[model samples]
Target: MGLRGRWGGRAAIALCVGAGVWLLVTALRDGWGRADPVASVFGSVAGLAALVLALRAIPAPRPPVPRPVPPEVPEWWVDRDEADAVVRAVRRRTRRWRSGGSVAITAGLHGAGGFGKTTLAKYVAAQRSVQRRFPGGVHLVTIGRDVRGPAAVAAKVAEETRLITGDTVETGSDPERAGNHLGSLLAQRPRTLLVIDDVWEHEQLAPFLRGAPHSCVRLVTTRKT
Candidate 1:
């Protein structure tokens, strides 16, 4: 709660408590046995109001709100020609799959840390041609060294894809089940583009690759070749 809200609640509670105490004291001083019925009733009401106010003064927990996912498009991109070149290359390599073939296309963009590999991948994924080709939509997952392991990576992808049916794959502990579930979901889709970014090891890509559709195009970005 804000400062204003807290102060307001405290003031309300104080007023109620003070009123209740004053009424009880007045009733006792006048001798409750001889007190008027109206005085007794006022005292009871004031005490109840004070008790309710005190209870309300205690804070209740707020429910958690889901965070909004960031958009795939970059805020500002430099070197449009470079991004276009990479996009064209990706399209050329994956063109065979668009012709009713079941070949899975994989491309790696390896460079130094700040070389904008992820940005380029986002640009490619956002292309009209790419979107038109993959009707299932483009999904991006970040699996850096900080990511626990294959299981964690799988769980993250599953969450991003909204594939969590129950507690089967919470926190990505069951990689096999998560991978299989994800794969089954993707297999049902016609085509999809999976962009795996900031990968630190080749092994981290296994679970995601296992679930990807045969006609899907996988774009990987990493500092290592």
Candidate 2:
């Protein structure tokens, strides 16, 4: 008939075959005609009860969900109120940092380079509330030897912003141009958090922090005062 009907018929045949095999085995082991039917039934019932108890004792493994990519966003593993407060504080700090005046988030993060500043920044950026606040999305730039000048900073920011610096803005053309372009980008957004990690000098903080637009926030994670 149908595939489902065929499967059902096959299953029925398989079950019947299994039962017949079990009966034949039982008869061979205990002389079926000579054995007491009641005793046999009671033994079978007891065996089934033991089997069920054993099955219940064993723990079943949870099934895995197949997906193309795992979610990168952090699930709320903490209390809702605490999470909401953290998000609000972040947004508020973002606003304060973006303001014309210099604002510093001075928390004593122990250790040197190996300290978890970058990780914490990333986690904060990935927060659902922060993500919602900045629909333009978050950009992370790591400053190093290759990233010595303003041009490199612009290039990194452009990359983070998901735009080619040459095609969209000329931050890489010159230091002043790069600074202006970066500032403009930061200012253009309604709410953006610009994080500068592992700073070595007070001068390094000046360009990115100074004269930035009120729209975006600048967050610096530095070792020095």
Candidate 3:
């Protein structure tokens, strides 16, 4: 119930309880004697009725709201502890103070192919705690080996931006320009987590890394050392 209704209910309950107590006291003073037998009986009954009304005026408790749950990992995945450790390290790094304010926290997972680096990145991003910090959401984009051209990389970045924001993006053959555009979109969202997967070279990553804002944390996965 609303504030007014709640107060109103409480007031009514108090009034009923007071009335019941007064009636009971008066009935007890009469002692159910012949002096006023009818009044004593009537007061006792009215007291009980008022008490019942008081009890009925109490409000029922509301049910508890459920908390948000993280998405479950794949059944075949077994590196849960590694994913959790990555999450902790990322969070700890984010909490550290930076002179220029919140600095860009870019976490890289580099290893040979088939080592589950991308899988761990996904698992870490899907965590409920990570989502709480990065409410803008974790946007993942794959920059595979074939996507080396400026136009292709730009298109991939724009496509990923469009996928997440649902807003139309205008991109060109300039990789830096496209990354800057995507960065602007990410900045609009508070504490965004951008996962650029399967990065192959410095040329492929520099644009995205340079353009991303301090609020956006980059989790890049690359097979190349």
Q: Which has the greatest TM-score?
A: 3
| Residue-level lDDT tens digits of model 3 in 1-225 | 556556656666666566556656666876535336555565566566655655665666534323224446778878656687789876655566344656546788899999998889878877778878766666777788988788887777667767756656577778888778877776665666677899998778876775545667788899987
TM-score of each: 0.57, 0.47, 0.62
Stretches off by above 4 angstroms in model 3 are 1-71, 97-104
Mind giving the per-residue lDDT tens digits that candidate 1 earns over 1-225? Answer: 556557656766676676666667766888655455755675576667656765666677544323223346756666666777777766665676557666646778899988888888887877787777666666677778876776666667667556322223353566666667777766766676678899887667766677554645678899988
lDDT of 3: 0.70
Against the true structure, whose lDDT is highest?
3
* Clash counts for all predictions: 1, 0, 0
Ten-residue region with minimum lDDT total, candidate 1: 163-172
RMSD to true structure for each model, in Å: 13.7, 20.1, 14.4
The window of 10 residues in a row where model 3 has the poorest summed lDDT is 62-71
Model 2 has how many clashing residue pairs?
Answer: 0
Q: For residues 99-144, what per-residue lDDT tens digits would candidate 2 score against the true structure? A: 6465554222223675655556556666777777654444444444
